[model samples]
Each structure stands twice: as structure tokens, then as C-alpha cells.
Target: MADIPAEGLPPADYAALCDFLRARTGLSFTEAKRYFVDRRIAARMAAVGVATLRDYLNVLRFQASGEELQRLVNLMTVNETYFFREKYQLDCLVRSVLDELARNRRPGSRLRIWSAGCATGEEPYSIAIMLLEQWSRVDEYEIEILASDIDSAVLERAREGIYDERALQGLPAHLRSKYFQPVRGALAADGARWRIIEELRESVDFSLVNIADPRQVQAFRGIDVIFCRNLLIYFDDLGRREAAGMFYDALAPNGFICLGHSESMSRMSSLFVPRRFPDAILYQKPAEGGAS
Candidate 1:
């Protein structure tokens, strides 16, 4: 808020900054987001003691350590997520998607599920809980749950697996009691904080991943189901297409991808086939030896 130009970021400078972010992180911002962007940049500049927007840009571009850039990124990325944010998708996953995928796998085969934009550890942890509580054959297979995000700060918080009451709002009382226990000590008496039980926490693996980066996404392969809900909406068309291609490559034949309820793969790419179920519609990659 301090030391910003009286007129705010010059249009040219704003455009340049937006272009830089889109190139590096696949986040697209229009004029509508100018205020949000301006505020974040101004805050970061103040933190780093850069008095001018041009000087901040130079730091982002030429800084050898890349620490400031990471800090800027940490501030800009959104991390508004909570446990079971969309319960229908999880119901669809356990009730239909997993059942369909398991039909093709033998007992003891590995099944990998990814939470592509997991924030604060809730989404993937929700998935793990669903499988353990609802799926009958969960123990028959080797299950791997991987949750990732681009924001290092959120990833660190997610790895800690602690949540306050608000983050657990979507969870029912029974499920909360079953899976999470109150944090110890005097301050926890009000039940303001809860830590996921060690067993459930250890079941999920958290990592820092930028879904927009082709090189970073290459490490994820043979994933059976990908829960990328609510994330692609932030990307520009080109970024969305690139991400779709990367996901297609990472999935095994006949693997599936789940987007937010409002997101439609049909609008972005023709590579996935939309499959309808009672609870939700999911996009699936073409099976091996089948038409794409």
C-alpha cells in the first residue's frame, strides 16, 4: 500500500508483470484483477525494500537466488480450500470411478490417485478417509495418494496435517471424530485445533508441484485418477491445454481426470471422453487400443 505510484501500476508495467506471471506459473489475470495484483506486488515490494515497480521487476527477473521470486509467488497464489470442499466428487470417486478402475486391476496391484492442486492437505486427506471408510476392497490394493501444490508455504502447512475448526466445516461430526484428534496441551482445550491422526496423515504424500510446468509434471506417471478440481479455471486457454496434455501423458490408459464442477474439459481439449455417472461426470482418457 505504501510507495505505490499515485496512479497505481502503470498499464504497461501491469501488463508486463501479468505476462511474467503467466509465463512462469500459468496464472492469467485480466484488468478485473488489477487491484488484487497491484496490492500483492506493492506488498512484496515493501517487504523487499524496493521502492519502485521497475526495481521490483528487475529483482524478479535477474535475482540470482530466486528467493524473492518464490516469496512473490507464495503471496500471489490462492490457497482457499478446506476438507471435503466438494463431497459429491468424492462420492463419485468411491462409488463409481474406483469401482470401474478396480475391475481392471488384480488384487494387490498399485492404484495411484493424485490431488493435483491440494491446498492445506484437505482434499487428499479427504480422499484417503473416503477410501478407508467407504471402500470395501481398499486393503486389497496398494493405494498411493499424492497431493501437490505450487505454493511452498501451503505445502509446508499441508505436510504438517493440522487444521482449525473452519477447515473442518464440511466434514461431518462423526467423520471428524473418527479421523482427527484434538491437538494436545492447554490451548487445545477449546478444541480450536485438531491434528489428523498419525495413521491417516502418514497415508498421504505431499509435495510441491507446479502443474503448469511440463518438466515438473513429468515426474508423475501412471496415475489412475487425478483430482484437479477448481484449479484449471485460473489458467489461460493455452495453459489449460498444455496442462491437459501433461495430465493425459501422466495417466495410464483409461485413466480419469476430475475437474471442478463448473469446469468442462470439452471446452478446452478433445483428448478426454466425458463419462457420466449418477453423482458426477468425469473425463476419461481413451483406453489402450481404443479411439482417442
Candidate 2:
């Protein structure tokens, strides 16, 4: 077996750390995620020159201002996302879902889209771009995009709307050229960098939100669709159930949900029914369910 790092949490410490994190963030760390949690915690501990996990836990629990806890959360939360991820899902949203909306929605009604865990704003911005692409009469229809993430750091970046070339990899060349312009300063690399256009950047509203916190998430309601991809996989059963219920309540009746390609609401909650499209599978809060 490989040797454990000196800063690595022992079994008991690991268990305690998991409990601490779960209580605050509602994210459960199973044995399968042990290495990931360990590495993140160990690195944070090392940065502060802490020798034991117990000491770090004390800092998290008793520290004034809760800065340490926020730091840990920022480090622990995964923010791996790119433009136009899971293209088929976006395609379905633009084609099938929007078709349903256009037919059913009343006149002068806006489409409200929430991108939960919208790290760095790619998902919500993608939604906006897709809406613009699919809807020709853009000026006639209002589009409201609310993008949120638990990590404040990522939200700041999302608001900036600047990305390196790597983050633009999945974005189509034509769309990228049309929507982004080169940044002309030392802060960004010469031709390899781009920033979202003012119109598209302003189309989204970014905020800090913890989906596990019922009080925080309760603010989201009457949403026409939610894009919460690769997020529930990190939560425990309780967390998943609670978040799913919140999502169910947040949606307008018949509103849709698009999760990560690998994620499913089955076995987790009965709130949403599976809806299949030619290219993707989605979940829907039934119109007949009477507010789930």
C-alpha cells in the first residue's frame, strides 16, 4: 500500500471531519471519496501549518467570523464545468422544452431559468445563449437567468465573465466568435483569452447560494426550468432528498430539470418523473402534482 501523507487525517479524524462537513454543507463523504476529502483537508491544514485534523476542526468550529469554514468550503467544493457541457441536454431544452413552453406559456410571460450550483456561470450563460439562438423574437420575450453557487470565489469569477481558452473548448467556434471579444490588457493573455459580450454577461444574475440550506434555497420559486448538473452526486441521501424536494417546490408545475448525464432522481426522490427526449433524459415536476 502507498504511504499516507503526514497531514492526512486518520480514520477517526476522517470520520469526525466528515460529520462536521455534512452538518454544515449537507455533503456526505463516503469511503469512496475519502482520498478526495483527505487531500483537500490535508492541503488546507498544511497551508495553515496545522499538524492534526482535530486542530483544524477546532478552527472550523470555534473560529470567529467563520472565515476558516468558508475557506474549507471553497477548497472542498468541486467547480469543474465548461461551456456547452452535455450539448444534447441544451439541445433538448432549446428544441423540445422551449417548444412546450412557447405553446403553453401565456402572453408577456418571461421564462425563468435557475442554474443551481452554477460554478463560474458557464451553465446559466449557456442557457441564455441557447435561448437567444432558439428564440428569434428575443426582444418580445423576457428571459430571466439566476445563477448561483455556494462558493463566493467562483461567483466572483462568474461575474467577471472572463475565461481562458481552455474553458471555451466545448463552445462552438461560431458562437464563441459571435459572443466573445478579445481582452486587450496584461491581466488577460493576448489572443488566447476572451470575455463574454456585455449583452450576454448582463443577461445573467449571479449569487452565492447553498442549496442544502432550506432557508437560502426557499427564495427560488416559480422557476420554469432548473439546470443542476453534477451537484447531487456530492450530497448524502438526506441532502439529496431535501434538495430535490426544494427543487420540486421551486419549479412551476410542469417545469423541467436537467441534471448531469450521469445523474438520476430515481431511487432518490419521487417528486419528479423521468421524461425522455431523443438526445437526452430530463425530469419534470408534473403539472397535476399540485405543488409537489
Candidate 3:
């Protein structure tokens, strides 16, 4: 098979591919993203020995195994994240949200927090560390930190719980020393790679999830809090609304949802009430019998 030209797919093919991707993953792409998309598709095409863009699209649409589509999805999804990337939100989790939730729960009740779009485990791992360090009653309740992402490759890395210095830049030196141990024989001139302590690693449950899919999202219910920051910008307006609605349903009454700093839940859904704290503004579902 001939190689795809450096110029990339034709306009019609590009549009078709974009539409297909949006329908399947809820990720919106404009002409500006064509270069990014084309580069990845070209790589997949070369791997599968499919030269033309149209044939590649056909493979994605009709391939019986669906393995190629999964590969493409893995490639297209971005997994840029770091420990303590958004410290304010974590502060809100410990200082405000958990206190309010605990007020309504029994002493030994379960507390569930979901980190949707958790890439490479940093966000959830950060959540665990914050809970340990800041939450006064961390040991009182049974806390579950569920981290999920659409990218299987990143999920594998998340489960491993190993990270380089770049991924830990925002993490404080004190916390770093306490939670991470240097990986043996993985030293570099810059620094040694570190692995999250085994206990912390086991605290977070990582899984593959596509928030756009109602069936997949519905599986999670009665969640106390949700952290879905810095991920919804990829979705179109309708996709955002759909995901927000699913999240609302996933939460228990009066449960909280935290979006990216730049994201506003007000634009996505009216079902949540915005609660402002000094650290951050979080969205909350109305309790049973309360107005939404």
C-alpha cells in the first residue's frame, strides 16, 4: 500500500473523520486540529497497511474486531496531567466539601469520590495524598477514590503508579518524600523516578471509562464528590450537556462536582447549584425534595 502524503487527508475525508470521531467519543475537532488528527491517523494507516484516508475511515467504521478503533481512540485522547495540578480544588475537597458531606453521614458511612478523566493517575493519587495530609477525619470513614479515563494506555500507566520528576513538579517536597519512594536503578542525571507508596497506590481504583457514554456513566451511582477538571473542553456543547446530566444522575443527593478552573457548570447544566468557597466554586446536586 502506498503511504499517505505529508499534506494529509482531503477536506471531505477530514470532515468525515472528524464527524465519526465526535459521534463515537464526543471530542470536537475543527480545521485547526487537522494537522494533529492527520498525523495520528497516518500513523494508524501505516500500521494497518491502509494507504488512503477513505479506507482508513472504513476500517474504523466497519472493522469487525474494533481493535483498530480502540487504538485510534487511545492515540487521539490527550493525557497531560501532574500531581497537585489544581491544588485549590483539592483544598476545597478537604476544607469544605468533605465537611459538608460528613455532616449528613453516619460516623462509619462510606465516602466515594470519582476522578473522571484522571490521566496517568496523578489527579486521583493527588486526591489520596491530600486526604491523608489535610482531612482531619480521614481514618473515620471508608473512602473510595475511583479514577477513570477513556485512554487504556494511560490507565495502564496509572495502575503502575510510577512517575518522573516532571509529573511531580507541583507536589511539595515534604509530601513527595512521605508518599513516594525512589524507583530502584531508575536514576537519571536530572533526578530519580519515583513510585507512589504501595498503600496509596492500592487506595485508588483506576478504570477505563468514556464519560460520553450513558451506559458506562450510569454504572457509577451514589457518588459523594466528582472531580472532572480540564477535560470537557474537548466536547461540543451538546456533548457537554449530556455528560453533565449523566454526572448529576451519578451523584447522591447534594453531592458535589468540580470542573476545571476555566470550565463553568452553569453553561453545561442547570441541574447543579454553584457553591462558592474561598478555594474554589463547586457545583452541587439538589438534595431530595429540594429545587434543582
Q: Give the top-scoring candidate (lDDT).
A: 3
Compute the lDDT for candidate 2: 0.84
Better of 2 and 3 by TM-score: 3
Error of 1 at 16 (Å): 0.2
What's the lDDT for residue 64 in model 2? 87
Q: lDDT per residue, candidate 1, 178-265, as tens digits?
A: 9988887875777789989899888989887888888999999999999999888889998898899999999999999999989999
Candidate 2 ranges beyond 4 A from true positions = 1-7, 48-51, 290-292
Clash totals, every prediction: 0, 0, 0
CA RMSD, predictions in order: 1.9, 3.0, 1.8
State every prediction's TM-score relative to the real structure.
Answer: 0.95, 0.91, 0.95
lDDT of 3 by residue, 23-100 (tens): 988888889988888889888998999878888889989999878988998998888889998799999999999999
Give the runs in model 3 whose Cα sits over 4 Å from its true position: 1-5, 186-191, 289-292
In model 1, which regions exceed 4 Å deviation? 1-3, 186-191, 289-292
